[model samples]
Target: MLVAVLATALLVGCSPRSEPAPEVDVTGGAGEEPSLEYTPPLTISEATSEVLWEGTGPELEDSGPVLLDYRLQRADDGSLVEETYSTVPKPFTLTPEVLSADLHEALDGRTVGSRLLLLLPATSDTSSFASVMVVDVRPTRAWGEPVEPREGLPAVTLAEDGEPLIETPQGDPPRSLVVQALLRGDGDQVVEGSTVTVQYTGVRWSDGSMYDSSWVQGGPESFDLGSGVLPGLAEGLLEQTVGSQVMLVIPPESGGAVGGEEDTLVLVVDILATSAPAPDALTEEG
Candidate 1:
């Protein structure tokens, strides 16, 4: 839900509109360096796509956390416009706005580890440009490694689909915020200001009313922890290692934000990944 992520926690989700993957031609297959070559049609008037290579991994579901390495080129001449080959594959949550309608139609039901090429027909609208995107889908974490459920505080359980089932603990809510790490990762520690990608769920401490859930949305969400976020979230997330799942019980907001200011908030944050450290303005004068 793009519902005030600063005031509310950001989660991922997709709409009910989706169709089966389309069949198309791709130049390369899995286990090889990915590549795609699309010959522009002589009578191009519509967008079209083909699967350059098929992945043997799981078929993508409607709501997704798909990773892709894509190269964009002009549809008219196939001239390179941009690419992600130098860097790592990027993550694309299967949300309604993740891509343009034409591209979304191309990606529906594509498998993890598949490669695809999308060819766009010249646009009648002046606001957009026609282009081709060569995409290499990669496998990403479906779920964090399971850890023993911690007792005390609210008990957290997982559904068959990996969505968190929070059982708010009985007792007077903590006067101060609480942070507890459930699972740990060997990846980079979450530094202050690092763009952190995570899956999370938030609920009101009063009646256990869920306010947000990434699992429900579709996949994981990324946020800059260093930005002016909630005191409870910044405190709970800063310096925590990536791949760690932490629980936070906040004692109501004292100032600006979404959600109830009097209602104590509870959050289960899973630090799935981190990237793009905030640029340093602290450099000494050269």
Candidate 2:
């Protein structure tokens, strides 16, 4: 039933004449019929400085357009409400063309990075009554650490320098990842600055299916170590202490793949070796 509703909502959302409605519930909870005239308040969760500057920063004498990346949460329970990282105005303009009347009245001339709590009055039958929203507005650079970093997992270990290495197979995969300990390193001959060569394999988390691998091709895939790879890959390889095995759960968005399906990816990599090739070696023969 929930899937049906979500599928319907997605279809409606893509309609040409339709406007995407914020996921505001008019009734507030499951099965409670909504009042005919209840409209929720409009709250700004996050915005780029550019949007705030043109829309609300006119009062500042030397304000340059800034970009805001923020996390919004529900004021009621503090549960994450929504993320507008890629919204049309993800880095939307505060210009006249982009600013809505509700925003103009609520945020015009407001300070950048200021947290604002506001209400949105519903305009129709489907709208909800005034609700609480917490907006943490900040410059675009503020977008950091999309996900909280977890401590080391027993199944996986990082070299002294923090690069992750997977434990060699003792028998079979563990039931789940187990917390281990933090790793510290000597920081010498580290995989930090130079291009480190390694082998890797990818598998589907849901069905344990192997999707792609550089190992199958025989030789380890040689990237400049850190260049041209996913953040997880870059971080994993660079910080990995020499000669360690690592397992990584790659989110779809970071995997350079099209996503919409609900599933995760598992990556197992072995740091076979690390070498800091000479500068001219880039053009030199292997």
Candidate 3:
């Protein structure tokens, strides 16, 4: 369903018409799914978007990953088409190659946590339909209050673009797992079995050499905390909030071997977004 909508939305060249953009009454607080009130059979001369509410977080200045929660409705009848508010928010890169020109313009210069209303006109293509979209911008990196790390751990610093730089400590790695929050976000808490989107860098405690990185992979990656992950990495992410950055020190027994080495693993993870399992899935698991 979303694929079809995106296909039509990304296409260029809408047939020009005389009708003005409809006045949509969007009613919803921040972090809630919006309720849109607009008359049916809406028409617009061109594709346009309006910022309903602005955000206070970091301003987008580059082509990077953006987390979004949005809803699409048929402009002709306001019929429900698809939405991401009830599930996990989707990720998209902020680039002209990845998004339509109109969408890229609407999202550019906007800060995280903004809500936008977009009016797209029908194209000449027979498969196209006019759409009214409401979008909520979620943070793609950790954005929150900073926290002080405890003493005697590997120090962490940030680059100009927010990537973590790790300096290895001199002593032996801790025998047990260590989970420390560096940036405390206010978003949803990660539960026991949630899927999370994150940007992370993993380094070895022995020589401070990087073993893995999501940032080096071009963008963030999603992980299901319940399976197919290092036991200590998954355990450390639990209870962390969205938009937070955390440091996890995993012992050899918990982190297992990394790159065929049995050394301790040090990971700095930026918790971008998290989606808890649905009730039915949890019931099945139980």
Candidate 4:
């Protein structure tokens, strides 16, 4: 199920109290499933959060999508309600409209790789029981072991947040497709006809001018490898692993042209996640 935070309850006014925030013993490191230990029937007077561990990654500065692994529990009896750690991590936008005021305030200005503990008091609108949540911030970009590209390729540099900056080489673009891995990942290999989540920057090879970018678009994008994508892009991404950074040099014949005009395209793609198409989806494509 999608994670949803109700704001109406968070906005309810609270009276001042002398009691400190309830103690929630969180046991686990970042990137792993966490275990929560606390007394049952806990009572909270206000919404509060505590940073369990600090992160060293880039600071969040925008409302872009932030990936998170979290566990939510019922505070009245300490029973698990929902969690993402045993499965896939979920991405949430850090906007007031998307998250509760308390959640937004707690997550805002925080860096990636941080873990936080949140307590929400019972509200009349949604639930009569309080809620406890443990959140682990995950990186929004590709991260893996760096690999050096071969000579004569465009130079690729990274910003503090892992956004790729591409510099076209000094000669004519390659005649055929070129796929080079800038970072090697340890995840599963991307297969043909699968869906992929990626952050990418596309630029014209002739003058190094950018034409498209997922970073500029505010977040990563998901694409189906079976259709609606350039032939060169699909071919280059096949067999690549998740968590990898790849550079693809596409010639004009491979859907690299702009407005049917001959132009090579240089793309730096970060392979973040991939999943096989559903059985019905594959049948429909077939």
lDDT of each: 0.61, 0.38, 0.82, 0.81
Off by over 4 Å in 2: 1-190, 256-263, 277-286
TM-score of each: 0.62, 0.31, 0.89, 0.75
* Full candidate order by lDDT, most accurate first: 3, 4, 1, 2
Model 4 lDDT tens row, 65-105: 78777788888899887886544466667876666566778
What clash pairs does model 4 have? none
**Over 4 Å off, model 1:** 1-58, 63-71, 75-98, 112-115, 119-130, 136-142, 175-177, 215-220, 252-260, 280-286
Point out where model 4 deviates above 4 Å.
1-28, 35-44, 62-65, 74-93, 124-129, 186-195, 252-262, 274-286
Write down the TM-score for model 1.
Answer: 0.62
Q: Order of candidates by TM-score, top first? A: 3, 4, 1, 2
Candidate that would win on lDDT: 3
RMSD of 1: 8.2
For model 3, state the Cα shift of residue 150 in Å: 2.4
Model 4 earns a TM-score of 0.75
Worst 10 residues of 2 by lDDT: 5-14
**How much does each candidate deviate from the true structure in C-alpha RMSD?**
8.2, 20.2, 2.6, 4.2
